[model samples]
Target chain A: MPGEHPQTLTRSTVAVRSASAPAAPDAETLHEIHRQERASVTGAPVTAPLLPAERALLRSVEHAVLDERRLLTATELSALAALPDSAVMALASLAHQVRLTWCGPAVEVEGILSAKTGGCPEDCHFCSQSSRFDTTVKATPFLDTDEVLEAARQTAALGASEFCIVLAIRGPDERTLARILELVPLVHAETGLNVAVSAGILTKDQARRLAEGGVHRYNHNLETARSFFSEVVTTHSFQERVDTCQLVREEGMELCCGALLGMGESDEQRIELLSELQDLDPTEVPVNFLNPRPGTPLGDRAPVGAWEAVRWIALFRLALPGVILRYAGGREITLRDLQAIGMTAGINALIVGNYLTTLGRSSADDLQMLDDLRMPVAALTVAF
Target chain B: MTQLPAADSAPAFCTGCGQSSASCPGCGRDFDPPRYCSACGRWMGVTVTPSGWTARCKEHGEQHSA
Candidate 1:
């Protein structure tokens, strides 16, 4: 017996049998022997075998993803979400593998310019710009065309593939909308950057106009699950947001819709939100953690734990295997040191540089992180 | 007393230098207001109250207390 390690030999020893010895050990018999040996060494019971239901779920996931290479249904996704904590690492590994298969090693970088700030009439409890909240954010007039163009130039200079003009409003007034429509072509013509806009809820006509004006994507976050939305924003119904997203799709513009995690929502609600996103089939899903600006209603809520954030990102990737998953605001505060792990968990895009109302880590630092991970920043392309 | 123009109109000129005024006294460039921090040149998200102005910077919180 080449006893390099007694634990290592336990399995092969059982596999060998003479005619005089007992009949061939079954798979279960070998498993039990290994489990007993592990117990002996660790002085604790090994984890029990997967229950029938859990095994069925895992088999389904493997069959759907590995064998068939088809997207999992919402039911299958929920089953994955319902996996126990002990199985979370497996889930993350599957999600990371799925991300690599679909998105490869390219990390798309985008930047946002807060073109219009504060004085929003809506009452999103997490937003600092809401007029209903007494947060430190101050009202600023819509930036002039030159100012917006300068910001776009800076965005390009930072090597971001996309530049978004974000306005704080329930919806854009006619003048504000007209100004954005005019600026879109200028930005595209001048900077050679993909232009995106987040001008709050949109009418069908406005959506059509934006599509005609060279706007590539329209962003309007659902912000949370339908069941939990009312607790976060009372002024607007969730249906209206859904309607606007549908309108954006009808107008042939790519929809960039997502929700904020850690807003006092239950795990079921988080999975539900992902289900809704899967239904929406948005071109991009920007996952924002609740940063909880001081003076907002949710300011007192704690930041999401790093590992929990990773699990959330993993779940998002598993839920929407093909969509561009972006690391948006609150990443710096929530993930902190483990930001790179968040990328591995299923994030293929980043909101580089500053966010709308808060600052982000420097674009250089984000680029360096991508370099360290040996992931290239994606060039501007319509496929995303 | 001079009556201010409509809120949408061009901002008033600087009294000190006779040029168009920006919100930040230090930079004097036309930028969207509430302007950047005068001390550190970082963007300051300012809140105006009856007592005075309070500007918050991301790197340095509450840079200006008026």
Candidate 2:
């Protein structure tokens, strides 16, 4: 009698299993699954050639343009661009329009002064300047105020809208900071260039001082997404970077934060970084494609492909909507032919010629790139 | 930092301020630097404190030594 019942149950189980069997999905069904997966992973939803719902969102976000509605949370944004080539292009185009709204047509230029070069105590794996790495970059003490001022002058003369004063330490000492205060005012008086600084870790007091010193912007990069940060730098926690950015914002300085791509982070991580940036809504976001400097942990990592750069930049435009998107660092070394394409792909600002310790394309070349692209050059004027 | 883990050295002096009780030179208000300076502080050089230094003030800029 028990066996009889078991046989009945077994027969039912067999029927259920048959019904739930993994069928050979038709090409269309397979494509649908692929689309769902891509959307989930990239945050850009896929649609048949075009869909009214997606199109409407893209249209509303930028009436004159066509940037898609960027997801605010990581979970939602993690699924854009789940489609193949054509869908990707459409979404990217929408992103381009979004970039146009905030950044305008011009690619703003800036210069970087590695004020205190090399010997960083923290071991950020992507950086060659860290003390832990054996990169041959000369570990010089902080530069003189006058020298820093002169560099600002040179950048301003070349028509750069801003000059970044960067240091390569955990943070600056009091003596170095005092020099910055003096130089900041002097440089402002001398060149009238918008001065920005990136001196490692920042405290609330230091953020206020930088703001008071007429430092226009303070940059503290998230480097990567929260989920992906530990894989990049173990010495400093990701929360520390967030705290510094908050302090910078609290001090009323324009926060310029962004991430480095191609450091072996997943696509989901890239979206997560964007979502995080969206919440902060920084004034300026500098997107750095990893050049993978020699001697750094990521030295062997290859540069992110050109399309990926465009996709990310365009995505940034959509996500940020109204922040300065500066195509920084490895633009030349990474995106060779598509340099000008970035201007159209939602990159409104660029660091013109020479990076901290790395040689970038010259200012003249950048100007020509802008001219060739037919993009206008507008001065980056923020209330701060 | 302690010379050899004496466990009781009169807390190390700031290389920048040089005073046994050197307040942040920039702000000159906070008693002992929170990390660096309290105000107008810039990135001074990194100091390896025995107990780790307080995070430096975000605003302190480096003073150019003449």
Highest lDDT scorer: 1
lDDT of 1 by residue, B1-66 (tens): 223345465544432222345652332312113444333344566533211234565654663222
* Cα deviation of B7, candidate 1, in Å: 34
- Candidate 1 positional error at A6, Å: 13
Q: Interface Cα RMSD for all candidates?
A: 12.0, 15.6
- Candidate 2, residue A334: the lDDT equals 72
User: Could you give candidate 1's per-residue lDDT for residues A277-359 as a string of tens digits?
Assistant: 87898888999998877679998999887767887888898777778889998998888888988778788899887677566
Off by over 4 Å in 1: A1-59, A84-86, A380-384, B1-66
The TM-score, computed over Cα atoms with residue i paired to residue i, of candidate 1 is 0.75
Give me the displacement of residue B41 in model 2, in angstroms: 40
TM-score per prediction, in order, is 0.75, 0.71
lDDT by candidate, in order shown? 0.73, 0.67
> Candidate 2 residues A217-258, lDDT tens each?
988899899998999899989999999998999889989998
